[model samples]
Target: MPTTTALPPSVLISEVGPRDGLQSVSRTMPTAAKLAWIDALHGAGLREIEVCSFVPAKLLPQMADAAEVVRHALGKPGLTVMALVPNLRGAEAALAAGVHKLTLPVSASAAHSLANVRKTREQMIEEIRNIAALRDERAPGVKIEAGISTAFGCTIQGAVAEDDVIWMAEQAIAAGADESGLSDTTGMANPAQVQRLFKRLRAALGEHAGAAHMHNTRGLGLANCLAAYEAGVRTFDASQGGLGGCPYAPGASGNVVTEDLVFMFESMGVDTGVDLGRLAAGRAALANGLPGEPLYGMTPEAGLTKGFVYANGRRPATERLLAPLAP
Candidate 1:
């Protein structure tokens, strides 16, 4: 049997709660809960989080307080404040709010691109160009990341060619996106597909290639994430409680669950640096924030198995409680 080698010393779990998690839900989280959840996530040792989107408040009332959330999160020591920007206008707002990182979504599937952002892949690249110029002018120290959504497959276009995915990553980087990442928007990704695509993307974009954003629609979220990790991807995007989904794409289980993904990595001796118990506490805060929304995850429900030791060898309370149940 092959012995399991320890994973990297530290990995970044970029929380997508304020953006990916909130966008799909109908009820908007209260501004105070948003702040508290962000604080709790930071307390759980998550340094990076996509706190909000700089889109118009009318479009996503859920994130109407993007500036406030970004400002508040930025104040937390060592936290890399991140926010999404859909266009140049949004980028301006993000810059004004002093976000440490700004992400923009560019679709590889041309059909999906036209449907979601109402732009061709090429047009989206042009937008990246414009956004890049604005970033250089206003937020010189801030990072720009292009999140290439629907890179694996698309519900609208179907069969998003791998070549197109690679091409988009290269184009986005060339167009001045500081880094580029892949998002499996429709959740039609497999482990093999993930490993192959991330390998090709790394080869094509070099260091500019970014993290893998996956979904659990097919119950392969963790498997695909592991595949990507093996392919040399470092950062990952996950939502608290797996709350979001594409209304357009049926059965897509939003983003990967942060707690479960953290558990998978920590259990395998990978240092995610996130505290699962504190992450669950963050999720619990979500209930009061967005009442009646269903939060999904196995780790949070079944709890960690007995003797569950994290990568650092610390025993989680779940394991401690299994001490013969005080019989």
Candidate 2:
């Protein structure tokens, strides 16, 4: 019998605040402020960030400057700039903007597919194929990530089948996605369900399985993320200040907060390569960009545990222990 390898002590937290967090809000963050926020996140040790979406401005005005934002993100050293695309058209724009990775969300729930992308599950898979082909032709180096939204369950249809989620992941892989992953778009997942599904997803997709995108709507976001991590997931998608939700998924709140997620891993002796103090300071951009927007996080509010140490050696011990007291 073969022994299972232990999960890595460090995890990659892919910041999605600019794209996911900003999209759900009504106010559009100015491009300058968005760039500042991205810089701050990068300064805090984040390597990957979903800068913006390539959808039309008319549909989501908040992302009207997607191209500009992507360009700015690309200028950051060592940053893997990611952009979300709804279809091939959006993919083309993202490619032109020189994104390092492209995330294409395909709804696992039929009702969500129709409501969110106006396409059936099958049709979205076809779009994935088209986008993959385009990526190969134009930007073969860029990675294509198929994010299966509403994989946990849907508000409209309810009770999304586990089989369907697995099937969709397989289809995305077959359709040319570099990797496929599950998303708790509706925030209806529990720790047990997350562990089970991520295990199944890894079994099905193997190394091609992608990041875990969890929402904190039901207050189980961090728990669900930990479950996925225990189930062999390494990359996580989180938003600063827990500010995002699917417009089509009713009652869906922001994603798992980055500050809290980092605190969880760093406190557990797992390295997330993020500095809590700098990450907390980065929130100033969030506050400045979207004033009055409710930000949520435990660490940001309570501050890091006394004598906390980051897994990475980016911050000195004295600096690490001197995190600003939360107000």
Candidate 1 whole-model C-alpha lDDT, 0 to 1: 0.85
TM-score quality measure for candidate 1: 0.93
Tens digit per residue, CA lDDT, model 2, 220-315:
889999999999999999998888865334444568989889989887878888887777657988888788777777767776666565665444
Cα-based lDDT for every prediction: 0.85, 0.87
Q: What is candidate 2's local distance difference test score?
A: 0.87
Q: Candidate 2: TM-score?
A: 0.92
Q: For residues 156-257, could you state the per-residue lDDT of candidate 1 as single tens digits?
A: 878989999998889999989989999988988999999999999999988898988988888888899999999999899898888784533445466788
Q: Candidate 1 — worst ten consecutive residues by lDDT sum? A: 318-327
Structural similarity to truth (TM-score) of each candidate: 0.93, 0.92
The runs of at least 3 residues in candidate 2 whose Cα sits more than 4 Å from the true structure, single-residue gaps closed, are 1-8, 246-253, 313-327
Q: What is the lDDT of residue 144 in candidate 1?
A: 90
